[model samples]
Target: MTTNDPAGDPAAARGNAARARSFGAVAAAYDAGRPTFPSEALTWILGPGRGLQVLDLGAGTGKLAAVAAELGHHVIAVDPSPEMLEVCRRRQGIDTMVGAAESIPLAHGSVDAVIVGQAFHWFDHARALPEIARVLRPNGVLGLLWNDADTVVPWVRRISQVMQGDCQTVTHSGGGDRFEPMPILEGSNLFWMIEQARFRHWQDLDRKGLRQLALSHSAVAILKETRREQVLEQIDQIYEHTARPPEPLRMPYLTDCFRAHPSEFANYRRTLDSPVAPHL
Candidate 1:
């Protein structure tokens, strides 16, 4: 399978692709810096389904996959970056594949549920939606999750501002806007009955951990060395102003989740075309 670039401009498409692949360079930092999805959010997305085969689409460093496996779901984690997959491979019980959301390597109707974490916005959703629909069984669910900074706090808001800069490139590229309804899911005809949930969570991190988190962002990771250092220094200054050193800093987050089932008409067609007995 191949991804068709949705952006009309060649330069824009190239830039988007570069940003998507940039995380591989800081795969270790990404794994260490990123916050795991709240367990409550995961429970809500997966429901009470047991022993289900779940595909963690674009599963960076196996964060979501690890949690799913712990919940007794069989997980196949796929990503386009080998560097990210290398980290995922070290985690026991996660099946890692090198692939993208637009062109998943999984077979048709092979997964009971498909979950994307922090990477859906980077996909060419025009192509990815169909591919995702193809891999899901009838009535299978699609779940998208993002861990956004709880900027309701003044200090947290300031830190976020520093990290994002004037253009808000980091948030734009990193799937920000946790509170708003996802336009892609809303406009998509392939999925329906969308529902959303939010969970409040916090991560305790030291200065180094905080810096790693900032550096893991694609916008920050791709910066030239001098600019990157400047950004890090800014982040450090913000951290120092917000909290004392040697003490763990509390980073608040809102774990936003959206889950929906494949559209009825699409699933019906898939069922009719299935090799086995018709679902209906």
Candidate 2:
């Protein structure tokens, strides 16, 4: 069944597509404001390996792709936005391509692992999952990750509420000590042996950086001029109230990582002549 076009609210789908593409306009703020993935979190996703061909699908600004390359993997970063890919290209040791998850630009069985960072929710899973499976070699891995604010702290929780105004626009996986697995992965014939892990990390943000953080959000970036200004003003007030004298605010994040392998990897070799075995 294809999911690229679904029977749902047309307006909502259009809004989602618009929000998904909104980051390219504020690419600089996204790079500056967003926190990098923890090396340990990435290592866990890639499993025990080096020199593997890894594809960072839906990679934005190469945040996750850059870290994967540093870990000794041959990384290729792919995204739909050329503007975002431009920033990704500046980084060393990784190739950048303009592509989307629904239709990937790679050879069949070309990559050992495929990773998505904070971008899977934007994909049409029915189309993307099969495309992703097609590109993986035998026993390959697929990892999905998101970085969320640790809202267990009172101040941090308050900041989160402020950022999420009357209308919810930002999307987050999980916060604090909690991790919520995606419902899309629950019972799919395409994948199996799904596992999850979380890594704790921190980012230091000054007042200007805090504003950039707000601007980095798709909802805030697309807001009408006056309302956008109001949001920025609110962020400044929050910073003034939360900041300690002369020190940047330490923002904690819980990085949620999920990894799975194609069902074919478990019982079949993805060969045209090989008979598929049942998954046990």
Which ten contiguous residues of candidate 1 have the minimum total lDDT?
170-179
Per-residue alpha-carbon lDDT of candidate 2 for residues 1-280, written as tens digits (9 for 90 to 100): 1222321346655776888888999899999888899999988988767888899999989999999999999999999999889999999999999999999998777788999998886777667877888777767889998888888887777666666665443334233223234456654476888998889999999998988888887778788889989989988998899999588899999888899888864335356523432221
The alpha-carbon lDDT assigned to residue 218 of candidate 2 equals: 76
- Give each model's clash number: 0, 0
lDDT of 1 at 61: 95
Q: How high is each candidate's TM-score?
A: 0.89, 0.88
Evaluate all candidate structures by whole-model CA lDDT and list the values in order: 0.80, 0.79
Report the CA-based lDDT of candidate 2 relative to the real structure.
0.79
lDDT score, candidate 2, position 204: 95
Residue pairs with colliding backbones in model 2 are: none
Candidate maximizing TM-score: 1
Candidate 1 structure quality by residue, lDDT tens digits, 19-54? 788889999999999899887788899887668889
Candidate 2 weakest ten by summed lDDT: 1-10
